[model samples]
Target: MHYLLRRLGFYLLAAWAALTINFFLPRLMPGDPASTLFARFKGKLDPAAIEALRATFGLTDAPLWRQYLTSLGHVLQGDLGVSIAYFPSPVAEVIGTGLGWTLFLAGSAVIVSFAIGTLLGVVAAWWRRGWADSWLPSTLIFVGAFPYFWLAMAALYVLGFTLGWFPLGHAYSDDAVPGWTWAFTADVLRHAALPMTTIVLVTLGGWLLTMRNTMISLLGSDYVNLARAKGLPSAQVALRYAARNALLPSVTGFGMALGFVLGGSLLTEIVFSYPGQGYLLVQAVRAQDYPLMQGIFLVITLAVLGTNWLVDLIYLWLDPRTRDAGS
Candidate 1:
């Protein structure tokens, strides 16, 4: 209990540090976001209003300490200020609109890949020296080292250009309107297919490699040998004894995936012109949409932090060793 509490306290401090950096780091960039946005309207806003713009963005001709405190307060209240690029709309709204697509595509892909990888790892472990056991690790290592954008590139070339089968870009076909209707949903899926597939392929390999390695180590343990010598059915021993214990590493990886669902694969989105948060982040950074960038960063950070928190809880369930230590 003491150790767990200590870990929790450290993570809490880490989260606060992350939030503080997220609040101010963007504004500390060399260029001013407000001025960047106001570039097009040189004479549109008179002197007073332009000065007000400085105040609006917390760039007022005031002390840095006061501005920092004010910014911190606003951040606590979930007011990331009006987005300079979008003008008038709150940063939250922009993030809100894009969050769904991000969660749907990235979240589903992570879960699917983790499931498939875990199954394959278990099979390889159970049937060691079999065809899959010999071949899967080599293949997974190859794929794991391959860059995600390259997969998107190849898929675009082969599946899209050469065959004209899957979509080449975007979250949906041009005609598909945003709605809850079945037709719209189908179109979204159809458009989502290629990107999601690429994401899965890129990520699945890492999980397989990690889980397979752990399984190999677990195979030589006394517990596994004892289970085998007991004359239990091979299937029962394999699953109930060996695979269950080997799954802890994979579960940790799953927690990481859950955390990263908001931090979409940036290059993949860029290649496909997908409007997920990753794609938005690229543009936001380029245009110096500081508030928008900050919002996305915070959302992604919280997601990962929260996922890790749940991972600790899962550890207690999957491996009672942790709970035993607690007592």
Candidate 2:
């Protein structure tokens, strides 16, 4: 209980610090949001209009401290201000529109990749010197060496454009209505397949390699030897004794990956023109949409912190040492 409380407190403090930084970083940028918005209109708007735009964005020429306080209060109230990129639309609404797509795409990829890679790693390690160890990891890692966006481009061109095996972009087929219908769900999955494959291929090798090495190291540990000595089934010894312990490091990586899913795959989304948070973030940056950018960053930070805290709690359950130490 004490350990969980401490971790919670730490995350809260970290979130506060992240919020403060998110608030200031945009303000300290070379130009103000109003100026940027005005430039987008080719400066036809007068200086007085700029002030009005600033006021609309909740920007004030007040003291830095006062502005900070006001910003903090608004954030607490879930008022992320109007997005200049999406003029008159609140940041929350814009984010909410795209958040589901981002979650579905990135979240599915992370989880599936983790499960598949971890299983492969266990097999590769347990059957060391076999084909799985010698062949699979090397081939996958070789492909994984390419950047995610690079792979995304290749996949898009080959699978989407050249072969026409998948749709070119977007979350669903153009004609499909957005609803709970099987047709809409099938279209959504079809659109997601390429991007998800890109993410899985790019990330699978890391998890495979990490788990393989960890499992191999644990295979020779005293407890593993004891399990073998006890005449336990080979599968039980391998899984319950060796693979379970070896998975600890990957657990942390999985948690981080899960958290980052909320941020979406920026390059992959851009390459595929997927309508996720990453694409929205690009639009926000291009339009100098401070409120949108800040809201996205805040969401990402909170997600990461929240997932890490969850991982810590999992650690206490998975590893007895954590519980003992905490006690």
Candidate 3:
């Protein structure tokens, strides 16, 4: 209980710091969204319109502390202000539109990569020097060495542009209506295929190498030797004794990956022109949409903090040593 309380307090402090940074960082940028909008329109509108735009975006000439407090209050009330890039749309609403797609793409990729890589790692460790152990890691690491955008572009050119296998970009085909229907679902999956595959392929090696190395070290541990001497099945000794303990580090990595899923794969999204948070972030930056940028940053910060907290709870449940140490 004491340990959990300490962790909770730490996270709360971190959240406050994140909020403060999110509020001020954009303000420090050279230009404000209002000025960008005014320039875009060639200054045809009344000069007062720039002030109106600033007001709509919750910008103010008030003292820094006062403006910070006001922004904090509005955030607590779930009023993130209107987006300059997507004017008339509240920042929260603008974020909401891309949030789902980002979650689906990055979330699915993380889960798939972790599961597959972890399993392969276990198998490779269990059969060290075998074909699976020999070739898999090197091949995956080679593939992962290339940048995400490079692979995305290559895959897009071959599978999408040349062979015409998958849709070139976006979350779904233009013809598909947004609904719960199977056709729309299938189309969305089709569009997601290339990007998701690229992400998984790139990430798989890290998980595999981490787990394989950890499992190899644990395989020689006393408990594992004891399990073998007790006449336990090889599979049980390998999995329940070795792999279970070896999984702790990978779990931490998985939690971090899951936390950042909301941020989306930026370069990959840009390459594919997917309507995810990463693509939205690019749009916000280009338009100098401070409110939207701040809103997205807050969401991502909270997500990371929240996911790590949950991972701590899982640790308490998974390893008795953690519980004992906490106690």
Candidate 4:
């Protein structure tokens, strides 16, 4: 209980710091988003309209500290202001439109990669001299060494453009209606396949390598040796004894990956022209959409903090040592 409380207080302080940073960072950018927008219209809107645009974006000429408080208040109220890039759309609405797709694609990829890689790692470590240990880790790690965006592009060109196997871009077939229908779901999945593959293939190696190393070290531990000496079943000794201990590091990594799923893969989404949060971030940056940028940053920061907190909770259950302070 003490450990958990300490962690919770630490995370709360970190969250407040992140919030303050998010509020100020966008304001420090080079140009005014309102002026940029007005310029795009060739001054057709006159200076008054331009100032109104600035005010709408929470860019009032009030003292910096006052504006900061206002921004913080708006965030608490779930009002992220309107997006200049996506004119007339509230920042919340813009993010909401793309958040689901980002979650679906990146979330699925993270889960699948972690599961497959961790399993492979356990198997490889258990039978160190076996073929799975010999070739699988080396091959995947080698492949993972390549740049992620490069692989995404190569795959997109070969599979999508050349063979025409999957979608070239977007979240679904243009003809498909947005809904809970099977057809819509299928189309969404179809479009997600390539980006998902890119993310998984790139990330799968790290988990596999980390788990393999951790498992190998644990297999020689006294607990595992004792379990073996007790005449436990081979499977039980391997899983319940060795793998369980080996998985702690992987759990921390998985939690972090799950948190960033909301941020989406910037290059992967851009390569495929998928409208996920990453791609939206690019748009926001290009258009100097401060509110939208701040909103996205806040979401990513909160996600990371939240997932790390959850991992700490899981630790209290998984490792008996973590509970000792309270006990």
Models 1 onward score TM values of: 0.92, 0.96, 0.96, 0.95
Q: What digit string (tens of lDDT, one per residue) describes model 3 on residues 185-296?
A: 9999999999999999999999999999999999999999999999999999999999999999999999999999888588878999999899999999888777888899
RMSD of each predicted structure: 2.2, 1.5, 1.4, 1.5
| Model 1 residue pairs with clashes | none
lDDT of prediction 3 = 0.91
In model 1, the worst 10-residue window by lDDT is 1-10
lDDT of 2 by residue, 1-327 (tens): 898898899999999999899988887888888888889889789989999988867688888898889888988999888888998798999999878899999989999999999999999999999988999899989989997787899889998899999999999977788999988999999999999999999899999999999999999999999999999999999999999999999999999999998775898789989999999999998887888999999989998999999999999999999988877
lDDT of 4 at 234: 96
lDDT of 1 at 155: 89
The best-first sequence of candidates by TM-score reads 3, 2, 4, 1
Question: Candidates sorted by lDDT, descending order?
Answer: 2, 3, 4, 1
What do the candidate models score in CA lDDT, each in turn? 0.81, 0.91, 0.91, 0.89
Compared with the true structure, the alpha-carbon lDDT of candidate 2 equals 0.91
Best candidate (score: lDDT): 2
Off by over 4 Å in 2: 42-49
| Candidate 4 TM-score to native | 0.95
TM-score of 2: 0.96
* Superposed Cα deviation of residue 222, candidate 2 (Å): 1.0
Give me the runs in candidate 3 sitting further than 4 Å from their true place. none
What is the Å distance of residue 168 in model 2 from its true position? 0.6
lDDT of 4 by residue, 90-187 (tens): 99999998787788888899999999999999989999989899999989999899988899999999999999999999999888899999889889
Clashing pairs in 4: none
Q: Indicate the worst ten consecutive residues by lDDT in candidate 2.
A: 53-62
